[model samples]
Target: MNAVSAALDDKAIATGPAGPLLGDADFQYLRAFVLEHCGIALGDHKHQLVQGRLLRRLRALGLSSFTGYCELLRRDPHSELGELASAISTNVTSFFREMHHYDLLVDELLPRWLHEKRREGDRLRIWSAGCSTGEEPYALAMVLAEAIEQSGSKVDARILATDLSPQALETARRGEYSLERLAGISAERCRRWMLRGEGEYEGLACVHPRLRELVTIEPLNLLHPWPMSGPFDAIFCRNVVIYFDQPTKQRLFRRYAELLPVGGYLFLGHSESLHGVNDQFELIGRTVHRKIAE
Candidate 1:
């Protein structure tokens, strides 16, 4: 009868037996819940996206309406919250994404870091926050491995890769990907870093144990308390903060600044910037910031 009802009816007819219609109220409730729990600020235009993503959960729970699903979430927030976050959050990523970061790591950061750690002992640490599907961290592992080999330094380098979604973390831990996901990776590097599958597992590639040895994948929610006490050498948190509101972004950046030692590096998503968010880092390269020396 009303506009929202009409939209729902149209969507139902169009989808031809799609899951329960997501109404305006339902969207708003879910949006608020997600924002509060996960620090992801969903815009009004994301109603359709949220609806589409949550439909699977709705069907899985055998819910008849979005309202019922919301009630279930509210009643058992902890158990259901992770599922909600997983469903709504974006996990799009690739191998060597934002190649410039890797270039900087190899050309400048790694050399400088290796020199500094030579004095501090042979230890180097990097964190790949929001490392989706393991590609980013694996790429870092590959670069670090190569850098150690080229420089002939016994730099005990390691990467800590974390993501909020258990599902994403599981996939990352498996470290196996299809051929289509291997785009931009060269044949030579692929042979060195990944184990190619054959026969039934054709076209799939698994990360080599040598490479996997350099990365530790774990579940972490950036919005919540961090258990690790870190003054990491560098952190790659690219393309992660764009979902948060300005204040949330500011808080997260401040936390990053605290976690990074003086002169450490912070890498952001290409579209993300610290210009208005935080002042603790100086822009050294495209989408890259170095912590101001205290």
Candidate 2:
């Protein structure tokens, strides 16, 4: 099975008779609700996976039946939307998960932007559009911090990390991770950027204050209205649109294009492509696109 299928199937065991079973009508309502609110298209086969995942949520909310859960959504979808999306959607991410994207920033983009921005006094903004538990943005901040110091440029730069999952955003805000989670980071970066915990907090690592200062974490549902005005130099929306339907992808990419200037970059997941979805961005590198002048 594919990785996504495997992830969705993880721990998706059939509930016992003691627990409430997800009925067909309620399942359909959930499918539709998730699609409209979160932009994730749930296939018919995902019913059991959804049921298994949401069972935890049901228990948390003191709900005994799927009907009760659906009623909660009906009463106020926004109240439960983040928790619902967190249950259904996968947020598997890591520090420097896709290293090449960071390499591109370090080798080419950052230097050029710092140089140009130093001359023009323009601010640099990179949005980590689905930042998950903060690893990605912190990773970006490491490279960005290194670039600024090396270039000796006083270019105002920052990374905006946003995600829809309340739980994930809470972890991101905390910025602490188990030592094992540091595997993806290089040894030098780990030494330089990670503060090792002690005594009761042993085996945990916290990000340096510089990374926190560079990244602004916020809660954002990509399908909903965005509060920030833009002309962002680049956007890292990796592994996010894979769940979106065609129309949703089209709308999201169009919105992204509107916020990016001509020649601005859009970095996507390794498995995702803009082909036959959006024509405003030209393929510039592996899983990278640049906005084209109209």
Candidate 3:
């Protein structure tokens, strides 16, 4: 056999799974590699997750193996640099995914914020970091609108919703959702905040035009420097950071601390916690953290 063919054979041996579950050594190697490059780390349980998410990309790239793909990332730099992040990053979100956070925002945070600002401002700023499919931000706008109307207050509010997935951002910008995803949204909120489509658009409800106007969707990679200037009053960053390593999470929290002001709020996913890594935030509940007045 020629040298090239021999090299290919050797590469295959390294790339293919090394064990029953996953090649644990290779998994550790890949995790370390990814963390160095992107600040994301894969752990013990994510073996299947890495395989399932990156396997298709491997096929698409005509790369026969994960080892080869890792080589590409290491050497080319641009050779599908973002593809793996796209694969592994969790994008699951819905309109009001965890409803109580919205309740707390409307009932607790916004009211107090408004009172503190008093004649100084009518605008409220929010960053929906890791905003997936736009539903969360749209739902936020709906809730804020209701709160403003009920308070007999005219509040100018805008939400900066960013996500790494272009596809996800497009879905969010469309503001069109299937009926099944509307489960958490109440019928009353629906009538007031949605336009029920007819004919070919049947069974899909589009967000109200006014609500759509409230959110600005942007494509962003959280691993990179953020494209925002803030002193935002609140940030809804949920269900995305669980994939990162402890150090990365701590670094992200420091950044979060900078973006939000004293007494600002940070909402995390139900499964996430600020317990061990950072001391900057006070845990209010399971997923709610308050940026202490600083």
Q: Which candidate has the top score in TM-score?
A: 2
CA error at residue 203 for candidate 3, angstroms: 2.7
Candidate order by decreasing lDDT: 2, 1, 3
Comparison by lDDT, 1 against 2, better one: 2
TM-score of each: 0.90, 0.94, 0.83
How far is each candidate from the true structure, as Cα RMSD in Å?
4.8, 6.6, 4.2
**lDDT tens readout by residue for model 1, 1-294:** 322233343434223266566788878998888888889999999988988898898777766567777777677776777678889878789999999999999888898888767653577999999997899999999989888788778777889999888788898999999988988687899888888899998999999898889999988889899988888999999888878888889999999889898989999989999987899999988998999954
**Model 2, span 1-294: residue lDDT tens:** 322223333344335665767888889999999999999999999988998999998888766667778877997899999999999988999999888899999999999999889954679999999999999999999999999999898887999999999999999999999999999999999999999999998999999999999999999999999999887999999999999999999999999998999999999999999999999999988999999964
Number of the predicted model whose lDDT against the real structure is largest = 2
Candidate 1 global TM-score? 0.90
Error of 3 at 184 (Å): 0.5
Error of 1 at 8 (Å): 19
lDDT (C-alpha) at residue 49 in model 1: 90
Question: For residues 158-225, could you state the per-residue lDDT of candidate 3 as single tens digits?
Answer: 88998876668778889999988888898898888888889999999899988877799997767778
- Model 3 alpha-carbon miss at residue 129, Å: 1.4
Candidate 3 residue 280 C-alpha distance from true site, Å? 2.1
